[model samples]
Target: MEDYLEKIYELMHEKGYARVSDIASSLDVQPSSVTKMLQKLDENHYVTYEKYRGILLTARGQRLGKLMKERHHMLEEFLRMLGVSEETIHKDVEGIEHHVSPHTLQCLQALVLFFDDHPESLNDLHAYTEQFEMGSPTDTEGKSV
Candidate 1:
């Protein structure tokens, strides 16, 4: 359900249409998988599909997809700010965004906006992380007993 919605969102962003082949290729799944999911989404009123054509997200579906994409983008930006590697951000955000609570998402969004407004704050993050040893429980100021 969410997977199909997310795939459709990605396909729409990449191309104008949500073709079965496009969704399958993007998800690395079979065309049969995409067809089955599309049928379900159509039944659920999330999309409109026609045989041999492609699927179009309904207004509800489009809104949901856009929200999910925003969350993913926010999580990716937050992870990057934490010094996570670019190579890992895509997969990491994919896994984490779905499970993160709304409060966490809002916090992440705020952090992204904050850093965007103050790029120098990133240097502070680096310094804060460097202050803590691997197993230490020191405070933010890095003072250890």
Candidate 2:
């Protein structure tokens, strides 16, 4: 439901409004499924949903959607810094976003801040990783190549 709300918010931001079909398309789900979820969100006071019409996020929905989007962005940034492939970053962010704790998110945010403030350190780590990856294989005990 957080994912749905986030997508709805994003669509609304991009297009000034979000219809069930639009949300469904963005989420890659059937419109009927979107309808059902929207109805539930409406009942929960997260959104104002109307049949054959657009959706609007409530204040609570807005807050949650913003947080969800931020969390996704943070995870993606962290993964990119680690040299994760785009496909893996996308998949891993989706898998981990919902389950990540607030404390962990804070830690990641701090790590991002640190890296941003210390580009030289980040560059050194990247260089070391590149060299490590290019080096020969290690033994079973991980002693030598």
lDDT of 1 by residue, 16-83 (tens): 77888878888889999888888888998889988797789999899888888878778887988898
Model 1 poorest ten-residue lDDT run = 131-140
* Cα TM-score per model: 0.85, 0.87
Give the alpha-carbon lDDT of every model.
Answer: 0.83, 0.87
- Among the numbered candidates, top TM-score falls to 2
RMSD of every candidate to native, in Å, equals 2.3, 3.6
TM-score of 1: 0.85
Model 2 per-residue lDDT tens digits across residues 12-130: 78999988778888889999999999999999999998887678899999988888888889899999988999989989999888888899889999998899899898897787677
Q: How much does candidate 2 score in TM-score?
A: 0.87
Note the residue pairs that clash in candidate 2: none
**Looking at candidate 2, what is the lDDT of residue 72?**
86
